[model samples]
Target: MTHSLEEHGTEREGPLSLQEIDEIIGTENPPLRNLRITYAYHQLAVALARLLDDRNATWCGFGTWASRTAGLFIRGELKPRPVGLPPVPPWVSRHLMTWAAPHVGSNVARGNLLVFQELGPLFHTMVTAYTEEDDAERALERVLQPLRPGLVTEGGQDLLIAAARSYHRAMPLPHSAARSQVILLANLQVALHEQIRLQEAIAASLAPPLRAPFTPAPLNVLATRFWGRLATSHLMDVYMPAVDFTTTRTLIPLRLGRDVGGAHGATTFCEHLTDLIDLELKALLYDFDRSPNSVLGSAAADWSLLAERMNYLTDFFRLWQQDPCLMQAPFTPRQAEDLRAGKMPSGPPL
Candidate 1:
């Protein structure tokens, strides 16, 4: 089925106003709604590009960080680290990335890169505007000139939806339903775990002065959470409906099977992630009584929290880099040899 921006509450006349965009985002359903949010962010990024000096080293560093960070979610590269690392839990196998489609991954990575390159600055501007007692609407409109061409055309939207569906169809089929669920869950968990690690790394790489600009105010924090929810929802609610059935059937039994109890049993990684996303949404979009935190006080908190994890993992990977081992199993002999010789693998493993 074809989807249009109009179906998700955007008007065709000229450009979308902030109110209209908010209403659409507030009321629309998943996948399409998620796509709309992405479209909005892309617009914001464009606006940010117009406002920021591209030649500034700090800005360039931020772009590089954003591109690399986006890669964690889109590229699906398996780390060289052995399984059972902090993010790579015991349940995750080293060969998980083998199941991913490199072409699809590359397309997704490119799409993500387009939006992420300016996202940090976009958020910074929004929050800064709020703090400065500026005309928030005017400031936002200046950055988001919706009259211009959007990042995703209708054809591009169709392609994205189609790509997501293709990724779902290509999911591996194992001998039993249980095995299939395990593989699916493992892939999801590993992707998210690795993403968190990458976030930590990106946050750490920025010097305090450089990172200060990216520090978000309460409004931007809410915006960040909203963007995150929409992104994840695009995968779970829109792209991977099959996940719902699998999660329903497997979650309880899987926990019981492992005899998992206490706080951990209360929620799985996906569940906890979803809950946090929802909580942030509720606080930002719905909660009227929520007290706003000080911008500077909490400015560094988010980055610090993200940076805390993956330190050991970071150190381990750095150590492994000194004497890299030959790629094995999934890699062909030639590919393995090239890797050992410090060359990029020449072609697809297949």
Candidate 2:
């Protein structure tokens, strides 16, 4: 079922208060709560989208995809909706409510707060700093310091500094506009990281086998997450699209691509693609678990498909992690065009 804020006929000008959020969500019924949480994420995604500048193709592409994907979830369907798949099962809805909804609600609230409260003021300051052409470095350092605290090593600092210097250099934005976009982009990266964590948490919670004893994630996984977060946060033109909530079915033409010229390149590419696929698998497993015959046909066929997909994703993650590339660079226009044409640059086929 769909939930729309417009149904309440209330003005959508500012963030909804806690009481207002509750009223919109209405009952604690599992399915309804799940839908409301989905709606909340949708609102969060839209807020992020609005912050994106069209002059930056990478950021805009990611924002557009994220907003669209969240919109589809509100309808209980994935992008490029499967032809005859039934609605989400009842038990899955219950699981979503129990394991995912609360975190999603809180995260969305946090994201909104960050956008309006923290980032909003910083953005304004950045604009002013740029306009004066003084104290810009100090202003940027203030925004960057909090994102990765102790983890940003000397090398990482160099990357960040380089990123700041070259940020939006290819674009024609004025100084104030460029600086403001940088601030927004940095915070947006942090917010998106929260979204990815929520997705991983939901997947693990729903899939019993994945719920192993809590240990630190493998180094490669940790590395990928770190660099992915850092690149988007500091590099103006670098943006990783939020993970897809479901299968691609048919590959949509991607407008951005990268060249994997060496071992590091291949590792980075796989790390990125694997994260996307893992999230997609989560949605597939949700639909597959205890599904009715009408929804996905026989149990055997469904299990087979799920197993195959999981195995492929697992293999990629394993092999790529062996040679982890902890740094991610922004994509150039030519590299992005190569991706658009489905060229592998130099790595294994995606």
Q: lDDT, candidate 1, residue 206?
A: 22
> Clashing residue pairs, candidate 1?
none
Kindly report which residue stretches of model 2 are placed more than 4 angstroms away from their true locations once superposed: 1-54, 58-61, 75-135, 151-199, 202-350
Model 1 misplacement above 4 A = 1-16, 56-305, 309-350
Tens digit of lDDT per residue, candidate 2, span 138-247?
A: 65565455333222222123323323333323123442433333433332333333233344332222222222456556854543333322221211021122112112
Candidate 2 TM-score over all chains jointly: 0.28
Worst 10 residues of 2 by lDDT: 321-330
Tens digits of per-residue lDDT, candidate 1, 126-233, equal 434434545654554543432223123221232222222222232333333232222222222222233343453333222121123665687556544432222221
Candidate 2 C-alpha error for residue 50, in Å: 12
Error of 1 at 140 (Å): 12
